[model samples]
Target: MSQMTSQTHAIAPEDADRAVIYGFVGRLLQAPPSAGDMDVLRALTADETEMGLALKSLSEAAQSANVNSLKDEYNALFIGLGRGELVPYGSFYLTGFLNEKPLAELRADMGVLGIARADTVKEPEDHIAALLQCMEGLITGAFGEPATLPIQEKFFTCHIASWAPHFFKDLTAQNTSAFYAAVGALGGVLVALETEAFGMAG
Candidate 1:
């Protein structure tokens, strides 16, 4: 996981909320949730909003989740013997292959934005979790000063908007999914909400 720097600038409440959700989903996708993580999920509250309902479902899923079972599910769904049920990389989603142009493009953008993959991380930089965490950092000034809305919109449009929604849709549809289905549902809603909000900003 990326170790983001301390926040230097104050983020707007809405942007802070966005950062929290992005961070939450990014962390969840990176690995199976630990018992403590499950406890956090189970404590989540919900309202009638679409995002809230997704949260409610996730909370329910977490309440019933077994740690060992979740580990198996995570392995089956994301990391299998040869390959998992899904390839959670942006390049594969965009190009039907890994280490393609999409990843190169993302790396180039990362250079420009002062984002760098940690030396400890073995996975490619284009993993969905990495990209989402990058966005969270941008929103919260973890990379530097918080990125402006236009900057955020540009990154989202170029990197996430094109493929993440479809990826989440696929995740939700997977037979191997149990706790992850709720994750996918929440991810879908978040991407949709971000897309719409960015559109309005544009």
Candidate 2:
């Protein structure tokens, strides 16, 4: 990751573009291996932007790991017997239930933005992947409109800010985490960055 400086400047919403990139990087940080993992990893590692480059470095470092290992790590973190050691679901984090207040709230917000949970997902819409996908959707204009800074902040604060940092902290300290430790580091840093950046906006 490029060293972020403490230079002072105008607080225009455009100044938040870096945070958007960081948010995308945070998504990539926690992404498990997919069919195109190599290609995606290469793209991110070779990316010119700071977040992309950071992701790329982590990706490269994690290259020796096979997809099955990544899957096992993911399962250990998120899908243990009946429940994982660290539940990555917003509803569970917020309401202490699998699909409760937090999920309802996120569903309402997603509906307003025209995002629906995938039919294939058995989990609630508050899964970390789902929320990260929402962020991606906002960035890519998937909800028929681009998300304004305030919109992004609201979504992030309401959903991600509530618990993701703690989750990543757990991931970082997990006994089974190895390559994912890098992911946890990236996530922890981004959460701190986002928390401070959003505070600046407020």
Candidate 3:
């Protein structure tokens, strides 16, 4: 079982909010993003429950992508010059620069949530994977406690809901994207689903 799934608690329906947070984290960690999981991606667009399931499905599917393809995607999305068609860094999204205040803000939030950046990770804390990991920690009690709905809503609004979907949309449409295109589609759909679900819950 995945780390998040292994750590999940059976909270009451009133605390079901954690499931959404965990699901998003699981997906981001499973793959940087990919284009071959369209069926699961489409399902995620329908509802939060479906989104969670699709995320799990994609995470599992990502493991099966050929090694060559994975390397290609990594090269296309992160190593390409002249901005690589999509910037997946939070600093870029927030300040039009890499490793800027947005990254600093995310680091502050990580401290608040009891998340620490892995020493092995060379990327900035605002990288999408790091953000998702922190979200998982917040929802799964890896932090002080599972975050309340109000806190979850605030986090989503302040961080994720602000720009991740746009990044995903660009990933989907980027000419160099293939495996990541599906990831972008999934990210776009999931963000909309999460925003709508939270809005309705309010």
Compare the candidates by lDDT and give the number of the best one.
1
Summarize candidate 1's per-residue lDDT along 86-124 as a digit string, tens digits.
999999999999999999999999999988888799999
Question: Can you write out model 2's per-residue Cα lDDT over 37-118, one digit (the tens) per residue?
Answer: 6555545534554445456656775666677777887777777777777888887777777878888888888787767765
The whole-model C-alpha lDDT of candidate 1 against the native structure comes to 0.92
Q: How much lDDT does each candidate structure score?
A: 0.92, 0.67, 0.62
Q: Give per-model CA RMSD.
A: 0.9, 7.7, 5.5
Pairs that clash in candidate 3: 34-179, 34-183, 35-179, 35-182
Q: Where does candidate 1 have its weakest 10-residue lDDT segment? A: 1-10
Kindly list the per-residue Cα lDDT of model 3 for residues 61-91, writing each as its tens digit: 4555554676666666766665554667777
Output the lDDT of residue 200, model 2.
96
| Shift of residue 186 alpha carbon in model 3, Å | 0.9
Question: Which candidate achieves the best TM-score against the true structure?
Answer: 1
lDDT of 1 at 172: 89
The TM-score ranking, best first, is 1, 2, 3
Query: TM-score for every candidate vs. truth?
Result: 0.98, 0.75, 0.72
